[model samples]
Target: MHKTLSSKQLIINEALRLGFSDIGFSTVEHLAENEIHLKEWLDNGFHAGMSYMENHFEKRINPALLVEGSTTVVSVLLNYKPKLEQSDPEAPKLARYAYGKDYHFVIKDKLQLLFDYIKSDIYPDLEGRMFTDSAPVLDRAWAVNSGLGWIGKNTNLIHKKLGSFVLIGELIINMEIEPDTPIKEACGGCTRCIDACPTKALIGPYQLDSNKCISYLTIEHREEIPEEFKGKFENWAFGCDICQEACPWNWKARPTSENEFQPHPDLLQMTNDQWHNLDEDRFTELFRKSAVKRTKYKGLKRNLDFLKKK
Candidate 1:
């Protein structure tokens, strides 16, 4: 006779089969500790220009509020590390996360499939919703609560096995499942991410001032790049990855197995001159389905121009 698998085990097996790096479950409740930290961050205006962060105050920390009757938060991690790097060393850099198709869609689609499996094959009456980074959810907090990983000093989630090159997604459902134990913080005494920041964005351990973040300046900030940051960008024409790159845990990160996360061949081949000369047509062609499209052709050109001016 075969031993029976628990509902949690069944879900975990299905999620892994769907290509998620790992999955964990947590009981849904008010994230009281995280609330205090979030309030402090917001009080300091650390969220910068993203005023939407101020909205959905209560729902952000309470999964039950987002999905009525929700009792479990199923968190999953997907590694996005790439085996390839830009071929031209002098070319403006893009963060590894943005090298492929937008993760929001990729992760959400996978989550939906997981949810469907749970509802159709496991819990026929299961009612839940899935989310990537496309919501008011505290993704890292939930991931931590689910024992997925610890939030690193640089604020990225660092899985001991997968490192910081992972993305997070979630499924909040009205079901009770055994919760996993939270992992211990692992960045003891290491401040490589802080010291590596070209713009001093990581003001202190585990504290980031988004206004000074290169990733924010390049991708999120709608205004022109601030003059004070002129030379600090280090030729990053889009998102920056200095902090993650500096994290020692990521030194041994294996490349992701997801084909959807692979960079376009032309993207890796573009030289500095080619990037500088990129026209709107080429930009569209290269980044048609990529996360880089978040920064439209004009924004990318602006970033390129900023690098040239240095």
Candidate 2:
């Protein structure tokens, strides 16, 4: 710590220059608000088979416990809005986030760059770690505290101006920074995200049934695709974007400026039938570096088979 807050603004400025669309800083505190919701969801088994969510209870709250003497959490949002969308209405779909390189690698590089820049320019002595969705860090809670955005009914960060198409990453540092004012809930009285859920996964405002969430089914759940959810996935083959598509904030959505976020040539030209018959070879060439690789070939084929099933 430099015994001042100037170093805090220094980190945020560097994050913006590095192409992060939004950045916010907050003092590390226990996840007081999110704890009850999480515990209840877990108790109800809403996590489905994501047993790991139940593994890190205390760590998911107090940042200081995870990182020795951690004082501040810095949250950054990189927009992942794709430059192109699936063209065919009948095409089996993929999430926009998976259109390019795996976000874990993509976001980690940017976060590490931020850390290195902080080490050289802001505080050479400061120690911290950066993680996107890859860590036990409470990224959404930190983002809300930092005022970057409000957690919408969909449980995703909803930016007032930037919308929900952003990718969140964090750097937890021992040094203090100028705290960002928390963003107010701009969701108003709108229930669009709740009402539009195909599986009725939205239990209420700001709540979701993760077991029924399409994204969870297609991405996180490793078991058989639930027969009940067969046609409810809409056209999404990998992950669902229906709530985002139904959001008003997305109306002014612009293409992300990050070139790494851009889609591959094979992905851009995919047709509905091509996706249906897609085999291992084409899968490797198109998605070798893509986030879709997280689900692996067999998982994707499972989803595809589920989609084509009568």
- Backbone clashes for every candidate come to 0, 1
Residue range with the least summed lDDT across 10 consecutive positions in model 2: 1-10
Instruction: Give lDDT for model 2.
Output: 0.85
Error of 1 at 157 (Å): 0.5
**Clashes in model 2: which pairs?**
147-183
Model 2: residues with Cα > 4 Å off, grouped in runs: 1-5
* TM-score (all chains, Cα) for each model: 0.98, 0.96
lDDT of 1 by residue, 129-196 (tens): 99999898999998999998899999999999999999999999997788899999989999999999
Q: How well does candidate 2 match the true structure, expressed as C-alpha RMSD?
A: 1.5
Which candidate number would show the highest lDDT if scored against the true structure? Answer: 1
- Please report, as a residue range, the 10-residue window in candidate 1 with the lowest summed lDDT: 1-10
Q: Show model 1 residue runs off by greater than 4 Å.
A: 1-5
lDDT of 2 by residue, 1-310 (tens): 4556677667778888888988998998888878888889889888887889898789998888888888889899989898777777788888888988888888888888999988888777889888888767878889999999899888889887779999999999987787889968888888898889999888898777789988888889999977888778887888888999889988797779988878887787788889878899999998989989888889899898888877
